[model samples]
Target: MAATFRRAMDALYLLCVIVGCTALVLISAIIPWAVFTRYVLNSAASWPEPLAVLLTIVLTFIGAAAAYRLNLHMNVGYFADQLPQPFRKLLELLVQILMALIALFMIVWGESLVEVTWHNTIADFPFLSVGVTYLPIPIGGLCLLLFIVERIWLGIPPDPIPAHHEVAPFE
Candidate 1:
């Protein structure tokens, strides 16, 4: 069941990437058009700038989620390596808990931000409001929280990592 749940999460992460990646390509293409129209033709494609900005916001959030799922977030493993086996497990748990708490706080704060944005629309890019732009914060927080929970589950006493890591004490 645990493996199945992980696979489901992996699939969801892949889906987010597929959508985000496609938008990223579209955004990259749009900026050139926006620039060309504004400079070469002396007119701006108003939607392009707003569209590009929107995609950038989405890309950042989705990327964070993907990195968290893949365990690619910035972490200091060398210091963790020096600790004794039992202590290492304890430290890992502590780190995961800290991450979880941080994510939770972000979620709360992000929700409030989103609420404010929804109520207050933008004037320049009025079509694209702050609520839409700030979505990454809450979404990323939720994703990172999930990953930290998974990590905590595996880092408990007796540690669920592979045998090789257990034997090496530093692996």
Candidate 2:
């Protein structure tokens, strides 16, 4: 069951990564074109800027969610590695707790920030709602929270290396 579930998660992450990468590539090409159009051609694309910002947020959050699932976040491993197995386990727990707290905070308070921004609706970009801009915060936060739960369930087995998994870059 665990293996099947893991496979499903890997598929989901892969799907999300593909979506994020495609969005980033398409949106990235637009900014330069938008710049050229406005400065060189004296014309503007109506949907480019707002769409770019929205796509950028979606791409970043989706990528981040996949990264969190893959254990791709930065960690201060130099000190943690020196500890004994039990100590390392304890440290991993502590770190997971910290991550959980951050996820909670993002979900709880990030809403209000977005609300205020939505209410204020900036200049020509009145359509650029803050609520939309911040949609990723809670989504990514929830995904991170779920990943931490999986990490906690998997537990720390003395070393960062998993028998099946390859060495991560920072390791």
Candidate 3:
């Protein structure tokens, strides 16, 4: 059962990474086109800016959930590491509990936000509902909650990538 759950989460993490990367790529391509059209072509395109904003939303929320699952989210662990072993474990549990609460908050409030905006259409993309763009909020929240459960239940999974490779810093 645990193995199955972990496999499911692994799949979900992959999906999140793919979606986030795609959004980022689209944003990169769209912004350059928008700039080119506005300056070089002398006529601005109406769709790119708003589309970029929407993709940014996806990148932020969905990417964040993937980061959290991989234990890559920003955290200051120096103080916790300095504590005694039992206290350190306690603090870790406390942090997970806090994160779970935050996930629940996102699920509840984000759903309400989506429902409120569901009927509204974007001016630039008239066929797309505003609420559809906000979907990543709740979806990411749910993914976060599942990952939190996995962490609490199974402890941290082994890093998929081996740690022996050295990272080179950019000049």
In lDDT terms, which candidate is top? 3
Find the 10 residues in a row with the least total lDDT in model 1. 153-162
Cα lDDT over the full model 1: 0.75
Reference-based TM-score of each model: 0.77, 0.72, 0.94
lDDT score at residue 123, model 2, on the 0-100 scale: 53
How far does residue 80 in candidate 2 sit from its true spot (Å)? 0.7
Q: Estimate, for each residue in 56-150, the C-alpha lDDT of model 2 and write its tens digit.
A: 88887777877777667565699899999999889889988998999888777776667767666645478667676787777767766766776
For residues 46-91, could you state the per-residue lDDT of candidate 3 as single tens digits?
9999999999999998999999988988989999999999999999
Local distance difference test, each candidate: 0.75, 0.74, 0.93
Q: What value of lDDT does candidate 3 attain over all alpha carbons?
A: 0.93
Model 1 stretches with alpha carbons more than 4 Å out: 154-171
The parts of candidate 3 lying over 4 Å away from their true place are: 166-171
RMSD after Cα superposition, model 2: 5.7
**How much is the lDDT of residue 103 in candidate 1?**
90
Q: What is the C-alpha RMSD of each candidate to the true structure, in Å?
A: 6.9, 5.7, 3.0
Could you arrange the candidates by lDDT from highest to lowest?
3, 1, 2
Candidate 3, residue 165: how far the Cα is off, in Å: 3.8
Candidate 2 residue runs with Cα over 4 Å from true position: 1-8, 42-50, 114-128, 155-171
